[model samples]
Target: MTDDQYVAFGLSPTSGKPEMLNSDIVVAYYDKDDGSFHAVDYSVTARSQCDGTYGMCPDERVNGRNDASVIGGERRNGVTSITFSRPYETNDQLDMPISRYSDPITVIAAIGHLNTRKEANYHDDFVTKSNVVLDFTSSEGNSCSTLVGGGQETPRYLPWPANIIPRGTTNFTATIGPTGGERGYSALTRLADSPSWGLAWWINDLLIPEIYVERGQTYYFTVYGGNDHLNSARYHPLYITSSPEGGFRQKTVDEQNREQVFAGVSYSKMGMPEPTAVGDMCEWRHTAMDAWEDSLTFEEYKDTLYKKCDGDLAGSLVWTVETETPDLVYYQCYSHRNFGWKIHVVDSGRKERQEGNNRGSTLLPTPLLASLLLATTRLLR
Candidate 1:
């Protein structure tokens, strides 16, 4: 047997108690060519909430489980997962260990790009990823390996990335890492409901990726929600509109007929970046959405929204809205109410609309414009 292999000594065959600990653990993928699981050139992370009672102490010590990381290091994309191999009972215990475990309680739970800096940005698509592995050691020289290989010493728990939603400010910047100097914030995932910032807002909530993010990636902010809900469900209608003759208007091809976007509010509209002092940048993040869940195809849900507009009608002004299932995220579209007729994200709003010589302005009601479309197109016919 391999040195890292697990040998169940006296474990009960039918014991649901598990031969190993239970925590966030993933089995690294091996190429089998050179006996290494090196595939993706990214880092992995595992997170478990602190279970201890309130009131942290100046000398409080804790630790993680070993069944956590069977094998953690470099790997492409992990296929075989070592689950429940980690344990999480220490955090809730009354007495903190005098010799706290090293690292987090969770095994390596996720893998992608390895970056110890910044905060997690959920803007990137993270469908293809791997989990983290926990590294542990036995109390003495004796060691037991389970499905998650084996190590020495006790297991340590890892913390989840902190989620940051920038509001009331134009930008959020800071330092992120074990060294403790967060400098950026990655807009990880969207909330079920829009996060209101009072006067300011996140453009279209059309985050940078909506996928796996790093520790801190200071995302640039612009614009306000005004009356529009940029952070809405994917099923909701959106506008890729522009302002004709300049500002916000309902015209794709403007008077000049240039293929460009309309500019939004002047520079004054943008809020100065949030102060870098303190931990303004997303140094930590808490991911609420599940990584694995059954979902509909992007095309399937898009068809439903198309039927609502009945776009093909000749005399009617038409716009396209693209979206995904669950309707909480993944949405895009175009609106006749825009000047350059660009693909405007509702959440990002005017901030993303800043393009071309055209400026952003209010559009006439859709009903009024629809009437004009019918009249003008019919007359031309």
Candidate 2:
């Protein structure tokens, strides 16, 4: 039974430098007792120089101090397919920081089993050839634009989590959101002030292209998601209630507090998935209900909001922008009212205005300039 189980190299950041200083190395396996797959980081090293012989030193253990997390994965075909993610930067001296270099980096991997004494042995053919050079780049099948949560002067950055699937597939999955760590995708401050925020599914943490819309054209994107920050603590599946004159108010479902009040404040009715329990994660996709409706559960709403797939907290969605024409085009979660991203749409008349400007420029008489240039050349001859 153990021979059928594979120790596969779980998913890593799909787009990035393989530089030891900028990326992470993940190894994953399955556990029969739990009936689930688990993963551990194999990237931390105490030695400044590695001899390329894995498992020979104390620093080579999988669960060292790299602080990596297994977002989510499944056991299929006797192989435990898992996805591993870490930050591109860190302050730890022993941990290797993922560098942002764009050049090619060499990668050497090996497969072996460890004994009860915690020692591993590799046969002669367990290593890669010296001629192999791995190229690390951003996700190719999808477009991505890196974004910060928000800031005042020097904006803070969130590490775009790596995904384990290609774009356009319904099965494309990822687990990226705010977490507690030095490089976690947390915002420095609330992004309520920016009239226009840069947000999108960064293809490989490399690019964020601008999306232009026309005034009267209707437009739509694939998905919108994020976590809620309450008193600096992160919560998922948060709901916000909106009123025409009263603005927005945050709400969540609680069993004990369903009809209870706290400190003279009453909780508004819960939204989708009526009877939502405390700490239950939720998210919203485009649905029949108006964007700011109060009811969390809808008969026709898309409830695929949180950063978890199949009960594991790591997922991503492909966000594609499509517009027919709009007065409003933005991406904001109900939980985060004062923050979200805005689309850049220009007036259709601007194209005609540019044409008129070009016509006016031709009035300068190019023939006269050409004649003057000819005379100057003749004089020189």
Candidate 3:
């Protein structure tokens, strides 16, 4: 059935509840005569006020479902473009394969429309849909050629073309995954931590990437908590925090134990030292020596002053970039406020080393050093 099919209906099937009202439309289908790219999921129900008219009820049929293949669309003017075909390898084990070219496959979307049909309910609206990355090695043409397909309405952010981590930011690695939504809606995935959800921080390993830094340069982040889709029961507990405001929505459970109010500071009243209670989950500091105060201990401040890693913050924890840090620094995830990472701190190597020492002190002073500095300023006047 195809009437411009791009249905991403009300998702939450694993108990974030709210199923079938609409939300979760992430379709990235690209198959330029077999270069391949297909990852689809759908289900959409609507009726906010049909008897009155706010979003204007029904032309209804959005009920597509479960993994890869055979969907097509076209709605024109009001916009709705869709086309589908799947198989770069698919037995549909929740599908994910468009092989070769490695990194660039992240495309998460959300949509649950209904402004009024007498409003029976349908809008937990996961911040209104938008995520794009369907590049199958673009030599400039045909990667789904100009791509605007699928009942068109998937845009809330789309601007992926900036890596920025260059200026001495070391081999950083932040990879965590699985967020079709239902977790906290994303810092990577958070609903706090509900049944161990997911969250992310992917730079260098790519996937959900973002982490650019400079300001006095000394950054290091490893945090790869396992992901190849699910990494065998993925041992969650991950951590990293900073926020001048780029991420933070914990909502409660003491905002997921406050985690020192998300790095603004207040670690249990600053006497620093408290994580050794191994039976209720809070003791995994790899080492930051007594974990840098502020009353330390939620496992010594999320394992050594907010670097927290059990599966992969990656060897020796490694983190330095902090001269007071905060150009936007949110590598978050206490219990999950959407998981974590906004990290953008630029001074650009202290403004290109103060513009090369002010262009080497205003040049032109070399005529024998300006005649010995004007004969030592007239013998020091």
Candidate 4:
């Protein structure tokens, strides 16, 4: 693995443990000199430490005896593909047994480079956002799925490029009601009935739409969860996270302890000069509903009422995407689970080119417009 790129898969013997330390994992890489794939067994005994600090350190390892065999692999077009197999029951303490009749297993996958000395380096955010569960005994065959949070139904819309929001100081009229298309706050009611019910977000007119944004652009989310609107919005404070399905509350204890905070280009960095009344942004109205009008611009709200704002009735969040921002992020309710959707960050140059090409036409293409309209009508009903 000298100076070669590699992919590692960490398997948790338990259902929800995805951490590498004290767990069984397999690392695979392509050997360019031999023109073959290689797999190594590894188990991290302790997290790396530096300068008396205990966390966020480099890769440290206590190698395990090799037990995996590579079936085949190849490198083509800058992509490395590999296939490997291991015993379902390796009696070695470092090897976690895979039972075909057992429950689903959690898997964490990551990619990173190796130094000149062939030592694996740290993966700087080049990892899966959430642990994926794999079912071995499913009648439907080997299948993988994300563990949906809050027991809420899966989001209906798939992430589509045509639904992208271009760069600029775009304003979003944010509200909290039912997950889009529902008649009431069913999730909240379900949660009241059972603690497992999750929350959801409704942005503008869409229910938890997977939004695509451009780096170096600004977004102004004008939230409205006052007395005039649904009470659910009052308790749902929106925040951005690098983890999907709202990393606020995860299934595993280790994951729950991990910091899911994404502090880049946030309200705190924007010189709020005061703590938010609730969580990240200023409340829409601290007292009377009529105190703040919908006609007020983001700048106006920021300059006057933002600093003194307090309470959870409603609020606004401003994000200025930086170039180094992760390609994928999520806008989630701070206090609940799975209440938001994915935000895909794209290069500003690419978005600018798309916008320029569309400048000739003020309207969307007929087919796209019709599809959007139909979706809106269905959601409204």
Candidate 5:
């Protein structure tokens, strides 16, 4: 099953246009015995003129070059999923260089099938030419201002108002410190929400603020609490849960119970002494932990974004929010309660109109500004 299955990304939505000079296509094959897939190779193509079909001829400059590599893959329930990685800048003239700090990039996607000879066939109807663009480096949602040009400038964080919800990839820096005389998980990068002022001072280390995140977006929480003095993180490891009052050591019956309360995606460390390993000292025992383990394959577990470190100086927890995420969840300590805050999950596209209404007169609206910037950037390229 290693033939005729592929995904293509073109710089231009139109496949047979002159702008399709450096489009990238990844070809994959499947293994029936192991129920796994592999991205075998990639091709850089070009089309100097329209060919009346949605196909571009391979560019001769890099005809035999292969830069794509398979990370992991699996096929189950008739659905095949493959995870692959490629460099943002491959330095190949026939390939498009993805900028780390540039504006959103517009591209086309297509899929192909197998032929009678077990070779890749033409894609009849499996193509997507939507207007939506993707920003791979967007770590602070749509509100964060990205640096243009090609300098190594960090993205400027914009205050997220209460009324305006967040969308796209969001980042949060987590720190452990004394809040109201009690040690709690605080978001150092997120500004505290103030109803009267619309936004409060930065470094919300004292507020223990509730986090609002949108569905269908990726979130990265850089946890510095583990590196705090006296290794406070060893006892206050943060976790997301459905229960407002954490049930880490709660009893269900008066006689005997070892049930721990945990919900959603929990945390795990990167290397040895894995938190999920059975019989390990740092093992996480909970109902949700069992569910999380059962839901993932070995490959999926290896590539999971959920991460945590108990006594390490620094760590991170990443969660790609899905529709199944509960509307209300709490971020509480694994060993203790009330050390974290609420996490509100909102649906996508619900905040577009609200964000438009909240824009200032001096600044252009997000949609308009994005379009203008994208067009300008493309012309300059």
Candidate 6:
């Protein structure tokens, strides 16, 4: 799954060109004996360029490498997909460095590949089977009715593995939590959780309108997330997020303009989902939807969008402003892993914006401004 905030594009900062790196894995498990859900496996391709096809570590020195994997999947529409982590299913593993580019790229795909071939190799080749259990709480817990050891209780699926347990008899039902998957939604969740639906990247964690970075300057941005206190939180659900703090906050996307509120990290906790084990992946894919190609400059893209959507300074929607409004002044289209353009705003010394008019003035008067001016003239008369 691609991270919503950063678009993944294969770019080699080292090579300074588009890259078609190979890195992907796909694994599946089938019943060999009773065929009662035996083998469980997730794929892995060492070459996977998750943060947009590229090497996480260009070499060994920059061992800023990370390890990731994916697991737990059932065939649906003939396609297999699931979240990353253990207990439920695992994705492939990616342990790459962060120095490949001056900017760090996080591969936000299916992850946490436990119980794959690695885990299965725990016992001996003659392993009978102690992997799964009926108890949603205790995966290998005793069966409810039979009180037997093998409680091969099938759990429900999820976009990501949700803490759930199984319950009841004969019916084979499971829930999402508390009772340990009593509703048996795992299969559905697993079915629904796909590469397309794969949101391995923390949507809210990714910074919005990813800072149209400054090139050659060498950038460093950290993404932080957590819950109230982070008890079991390696990183909690609602800490300082990497993405835009929702509400009436700054944004680059059109859909976000409707926000009635703005940046308030406190409220984000109560209103948002608790952070899960699955981490955020920040990928960058170069895009030129609003321009000719990667060659398009940030100023050009902004000028173009201003021209296409709001027109030039002549139109009410468009304004050649003295200052930049991150939200109102969009300068990008489509998306790259985490950026659309790199810009450096250089304030010229000679340019003194016309102060005779309100600073908000563009090329035309706003209808509201025009109305106010006319009313003032009549009152003076």
Candidate topping TM-score: 4
Q: Report the lDDT tens digits of candidate 3 across residue range 185-234.
A: 23122222211122333455342334556555555444444322112223
Cα lDDT of model 6 overall? 0.22
Residue runs of model 6 more than 4 Å from their true location after superposition: 1-24, 27-53, 56-206, 209-364, 372-381
Candidate 1, residues 277-347, lDDT tens digits: the string is: 11111111113332211213222222222111112211111222232211122211121111111122232
lDDT of 6 by residue, 223-267 (tens): 222221312211112121222222112133353434322111223
Q: For each candidate, what is the lDDT?
A: 0.22, 0.30, 0.35, 0.49, 0.42, 0.22
Per-prediction TM-score: 0.21, 0.27, 0.25, 0.33, 0.30, 0.18
Report model 1's TM-score to 2 decimal places. Answer: 0.21
RMSD of 1: 19.8
In model 4, the number of clashes is 2
lDDT string for model 5 (112-143, tens) is: 43322222333322456455467768776556
RMSD of 5: 26.4
* Alpha carbon deviation, residue 334, candidate 5 (Å): 0.7
Model 4 Cα lDDT, one tens digit per residue, 253-273: 465446455532233465332
Model 5 alpha-carbon miss at residue 288, Å = 42
Model 3: residues >4 Å from true position, as ranges? Answer: 1-7, 10-16, 19-71, 75-78, 83-381
Q: What is the lDDT of residue 220 in candidate 5?
A: 69
